[model samples]
Target: MKTPATPPNEAERLLSLRQSGLLEFDNRQPYDRLTRLAKRLFNVSVAMVNLIDERTQIAKSVDGAVPAVLPRSVSFCGHTILQPEPLVVNDARDDSRFVDNPLVAHENGVRFYAGIPLRLPDGAVVGSFCVVDQTPRDFSAQDLAALSDLAALAEDEFAASCAATTDELTGLINRRGFNQFAAFALSGARRRAEPLTLAWMDLDRFKQINDRFGHSEGDEALKAMANLLRSAFRETDLLVRYGGDEFAVLFADTDEQGAWIAMQYLTEQVAKFNQTGSHPWTLTFSWGICEFDHHHGDLEQWLKEADRKMFSMKQKNSAAR
Candidate 1:
């Protein structure tokens, strides 16, 4: 039997896998649901989300009673991650690549196998979402499309995983986390017919602060901003430190006017903080709010609208000064 060839970016791929923290991930509910759906939809005997590490294939989630770990040399998933497309073997016994592989040569082995590589946003192939059957079967174009969709969802779960989602500095959700939670919030808003407002915030003269006080002080300013956001916004709201000095808040079940009122409170809190001389520099910011339209656009589009408005406000404030 031939061993799966190592990926060209094997070192980088392994680093991404380890950093993702999926190997030691304990929460398997989301993955289990996806695998279960795949098994039911495809009528497969085994459905699993498998993470391929350096020497072993770890099943993060499985719907069948299969071993949680397997030698990478003999793993079908090890080959799946090598390409950009789904790997489908109608009969592994008939394919030279997997013909002698123990998984197929054994009793009640994997006869039909279909797997789509699960990729991190950074284009690293860390694992695969696969469905296995004891009997050989044909996989149609429609089957491949369905599997791809499920695999995309699985990838989202990985991006939203704790290891990947948080901004290490401020303990706020990063952009990746925003994508996952924002999608869920939008879905919930649509279903419940509730209003959802998004706010974009930028720290005014933030670069000057870094230039004058050093990066350490800039970090402190960011932490202060994050803390202020936490104190001002409700716990239900989604707060994110969206890169450098940019921040965002998704106000659930709130309208544009309500969000504006909350911003007013945050402004007051900022003024109080400055008056207290809590830090070396005074805090100031520019912000804009947008109410999401359920029928109109996506999260990125919505974010752009708010960002455009915030930029406009920033420019106007600068001109006034």
Candidate 2:
């Protein structure tokens, strides 16, 4: 019943959701099968695997009459993703949050609802695995545990598909996955006339860490840096492990000024991270930003520009050091 507000990492969470390649994908069997099982096991009229996008909750799989897309404002799944645990409403009429909600007040009353957040390995809650019924009913502890297990299966499917596109070392999207999803993401940005910024970055002195500390330490540095980048950027940004010691982020709906602000934020975050003493060696990165240009009409060309700028910054940093 509570109006679900955006989480702190909304941008990153949404980006994680988009990178899954689930929204545009038609209803697939693994997802559909899970929902079917959830519906029957819970004895609910409807079961769904839903992903909450910017403005809408998209039903990736559904077992009942629920629409493919529902407004986020009206979505119980929206509230469901706010927490790490399952959200259960035994009787919507009893809860103030849903007593007047159209889904509850309308004839097709949603009297009993239970949803567990579908979390990505990166700790992003992209949506919910949920069941709904028109008739009021109480769910036992066993029921919640069962729902959680089904949600885990749903997460397993996400992890499997994500693995194909993810870098094994850092859990960031790999180059191949980036190429696959970036085109679709760019197309959406163009359609909406939104500004897109690409930040191409390389770690400063990454090789030095490997030489001094060992390969194990080098891997740790990569992961540490990836975690920093994840926390610093928006969920909407496409953060990728382009290769060893190099990473790339595509910021959507952000202009040059906005991109600059984001970069500044990262600088502050790194400084704070260094103070934490989490790593034996300090990490620093040089980056270049390329704003999307309609004239280029080529992703490769745009990335090349970013690469050029990044090299320039790296050279400058080396000279300063």
Top candidate, metric lDDT? 1
The sequence of per-residue lDDT tens digits that candidate 1 reaches over residues 161-269 is 7346778778898766777789999999999999999999999999999999998899899999999999998999999977778899999999999999999999999
Model 1: residues >4 Å from true position, as ranges?
A: 1-163
lDDT of 1: 0.90
Q: Write the per-residue lDDT of candidate 2 for residues 48-149, one digit (tens) a residue.
A: 999999999988889998788999998999999988878999899999998998889988879999999998878889999999999999899998999899
Q: Candidate 1, 220: how far from true, in Å?
A: 0.4
- In candidate 2, which residue ranges exceed 4 Å CA deviation? 166-176, 179-321
TM-score versus the correct structure, for each prediction: 0.53, 0.55
Q: Could you give the C-alpha RMSD of every candidate to the true structure, in order shown?
A: 14.1, 17.6
Judge candidate 1 at residue 308 and give its lDDT. Answer: 95
Q: What lDDT does model 2 reach?
A: 0.87
Report the number of backbone clashes for model 2: 5
Worst 10 residues of 1 by lDDT: 18-27
Relative to the true structure, candidate 1 reaches a TM of 0.53
